[model samples]
Target chain A: MFNEKIVNPNELRHWEGRIELYWIYTSGEAGDRFFKALKDEEKFIAAKCKKCGKVYFPPRMYCEFDFSETEYVEVSGEGSVRAFTVARLDKDEKPLEKPEIYAIIDMDGTDGCMVHLLGEVEPEDVYIGMKVKPVLKERGEREGKITDILYFKPS
Target chain B: MSVGKKDISCPPEAPGTPLKDSDIKEKKVTYVEDHPDMRYAWTAGQAISRFLNELKEGKLIATKCNKCRRILFPPRIFCELCYKPIDDWVYVQDTGTVQTFSISYIDPDARPLKEPIIVAVIAVDGASKNMAFMHVLGEVEPEDVYIGMRVKAVWKPEEEREGSVTDIKYWKPMEK
Candidate 1:
């Protein structure tokens, strides 16, 4: 038999700790191509599966369904909004000074889409299937990251 | 048709420009870095709750199992090996022997500290053999800490007690 004791609810104890660390992400093979082209030439690249002819935006080294190696192909960084939302809160759940519009853009010439911030348009004016083009940072200030494209503006 | 293997070839691009480590260093490929801000609260259960309360009173407490006759430090309500409930709580001496130690030049975040800190696993005197817990060491040189060295807990003033493991600021060498 297990011995039990009645403890007052007020006597419960807890310890406090914090998680503190910085993370560094490396761009893999397909990521390397996509980022490099954006930084150097302001170009957008997609992965094309040679066997199934499926095009993937935000390219990966291999096709997810067929497990076949993919080749990089250039595509216009313009698409239509498939869906969108307005975010009024920060990461900490505090309201932001200005609300931000985010959308899933279905990239042209590829069977893939990317989620990024939509700008240069009002939230009330944004509509599904609205055509959009990427607004990249200035050439000299470009970094090999997704932020290289500041936001998507109506085109 | 069984799906096993199929011959597939990727489309060829212009020869050259293979990604390598040099590309990263030369800023050919870019990446992102982020630090997450997070905090957590862990509940100290029945056994540790009492142990911490005893620490606030400047005393060390342990639990004893009648079946194995072993005193467990960082006290637990149940005996893991014997599969029986601990019979009673017992007082242990504040003094312990160093089982192993390390001289750490970096803090928990991997950042270099101004002065290196010495940390050790100390086996308490009244507990079962090889039963130890981690604590920082002080009032001694890094080179002087060794296995089986006697040490005593250096408690903070009673008025400053917070019922936490840190109630004992650090352990110091106990003069025999």
Candidate 2:
């Protein structure tokens, strides 16, 4: 019943397809307040658990430990570097023209930390426990994203 | 353990403030946009390889199952009903009868189109009963196209064909 066989691999056919897609992500409840405050007032906010007093940076609506509701509070947006790394390659595995320094900054008034790029200093000069403060974009150019704060530099 | 504990009670209003769609449009809240480059290559195996090759030559081909005496369009190597290899390749008529159709006013992305397009499931003339494939209709008004309407394939010029489904420009109303 079966008759034809394509012995040469080149005789087989193939079709090209692509997924042309774009996506938008909304920063949820606590994020809306946090990013808005940063973009509008140049202020930082943290969420504190109404029950246990644990504070969260990049604020959230509820406490992770006990699931209690949380409320927003203002912070100074200054912190100390807890850890650091130097990245020499871009996401596509190509060598970057300039290496970037990134760090996990432990926010001063919260029990939470944020990972962000380091600026205005050389990679060799960065160290753990170095004080750093956020550098925001020009007032008229802010977009209310994490990128609104351009990077962190030694205060 | 409770040394620093203070009185705690649930409040009527929850902590989070909800924003509306306008908030996003007016830049009242933050959002992120991302795009990724993704691609794929689909192999057209045994049956489809021959079918597409025939289509490139301005012909339509199908498979026949001896057990069921059925000719299947969009041909497959195995008969689904009998669970056996198909017995032969058969050429079907480029002409078909429209089984059902729709007038689409929107494009694939839900954007409005200036001119409505008629799309239909057409039962090829020489294939087994109710064996139909989806294709767009052309050269006829949306109001005039209906079920049981006879149609014929409108092929692109041989030099311009690239062995894809679009090789057939579209199906048009067949002349009596």
Candidate 3:
């Protein structure tokens, strides 16, 4: 038989540590095409399955449902706001100086939608099914990133 | 008319270009990078809670299991092997022997440090054989550190003491 003694609550201890590392992401095959087109030509490209005729924004090399190869197709990049939210806090839960409006935009010619920030519009004015177009970064300042298409503005 | 891989067919258009490493280096392919900041607080439960408190007082402690007769350093409340609660807390010497060591030229982030650091696993005195905890070895040259070298803890000033492994500034070579 063992006897146990209660410890004082004030004596509990804890240690602190932080995850301090950076990550490098590689855009894959279809992403490579989509980003390169957006970066160099300021064009939007989506993948289309010939068999099902389903087009995907943020394209992929293969179709998800049928597992078939897809072909690249140029798109106007205009889209409609499908859903949205206004974020007031950052990743660390710190309050932002200004709230940011983020939206899911359903691209005109694709079955998929892109989640991106909404610019040049007030949060209350945003609505589902509103027409919008991408406002790209200046050609000289453009990096091959999603940020190259800065945000979606009312077209 | 078939299902699975046998029925899958590709479109007539060509797939996207697969870039070589040179293409990426030449800015042909586009990519993005991001850094995420994450933090955590870990609780030093039952046994280690007391052990760390003892460390703050400039003492070393261990938990002993009566059945297995094994004294564990960095003490735990329960014996993992015997699957029972530890019998008692034992005060151990602040002395230990270096089990293994490494001379690190870089910090945890892989960046070079101004002066290299020597870290080691020290098998604490009075604990069962081979039970060790990692700590930095200081007050001795890197070349002088060796396996089986006896060392003693150098504690922080009483006023500076906090219940942490860092309470012990570092371990130094024991005088002959």
Candidate 4:
């Protein structure tokens, strides 16, 4: 028999567990460059690994393999959608207004791709191996930022 | 009385010795998931939360180490040095400069924001390599903010303040 209750607990009304959090703050230069590439005609850019001559499409600052200084190279934003998923849930797993087609586009001259939103088509129509190109934003005063290119649609 | 020129007030008088650990209370937040925002809120210790809540009051406070003459922001009451309990308090200035910074086109929910948010790693007036503070930048062109650039707070109105870092509103460039 328990003396009253050793560790008697509620049915657990909410989330209970242990976790670690990493609070990350990023630099402005890297961030501006990232969005700029996305805005300007979807030209994919990769940071060249100064060591092994390998290029990273997602654009890493230091070489993953050798920690060497990397440089940026704008690659052809045109490519086939390598892999993708339909995002039915928000970042917190809550449902979204309208679903989005998230895809990885493998650009020419780069080893990998730039993941972005694919629009202008029904969700069911999106498929693996779809060929697409970046839809650049209109001309005027582009601060060379992202969203300069609107959204990636059938192109 | 002067630490140096440049209008910085005389170095604050150093406090002597640390309080014995017998003074601290044993308390912590209930760490859990399924918040309206975070999948979970990481449970932090009593000292840490006290530091954060103080920020809500629009005050900058850090734990002081009487043993090593060090001040820690995001205040921890235990001295990482000397292996002693920190047990003291020191208020910090809101002024700081960009140590390193980045702008994000996404919000806390990871959704694309209508306008990009300017976030930065501002090294406050008194701290070390790991002591850079995280906050928002405003009133200056995103292009103008750079590494090592100086900035100060554009505090939220006193009446509206709730004692959080957000009460400062954003950091603005200190014109040279």
Give the Cα lDDT of each candidate.
Answer: 0.89, 0.89, 0.88, 0.67
Clashing pairs in 2: none
TM-score of chain A of 3: 0.86
Tens-digit per-residue lDDT, A1-155, candidate 4: 11122232222122345454544222234344555555544556677876677877767666666556678888766777788889999999999999988888776677767778888877798777787777766656444444455556766
In candidate 4 the C-alpha lDDT for residue B88 amounts to 73
Overall local distance difference test of candidate 4: 0.67
Task: State interface RMSD in Å for all models.
Answer: 5.8, 5.6, 5.6, 16.9
| Winning candidate number (TM-score) | 3
Per DockQ, the best of the predicted structures is: 2
Ranking by TM-score: 3, 1, 2, 4
Q: Just chain B of model 1: what TM-score?
A: 0.78
- Model 4 bad stretches (over 4 Å): A1-155, B1-43
- The residue-by-residue lDDT of candidate 1 on A15-61, one tens digit each, is 67899988767787688889989999999999998778899998987
lDDT of 2 by residue, B145-175 (tens): 9899999999999998878888988899986
Report DockQ per prediction, comma-separated: 0.31, 0.34, 0.33, 0.01
Listed for each candidate, the true contacts retained, as a fraction, are 0.71, 0.77, 0.77, 0.00
Candidate 1, residues B54-146: lDDT per residue as tens digits? 999999999999999999998998999899889999999999999999999999999999989999999999999978899999999898889
Model 4: per-residue Cα lDDT over B76-175, one tens digit each? 7577777877757778788888888888999999999887879998888765446777899988777887998899988887788765567888999898
Query: What TM-score does chain B get in every candidate?
Result: 0.78, 0.76, 0.78, 0.68
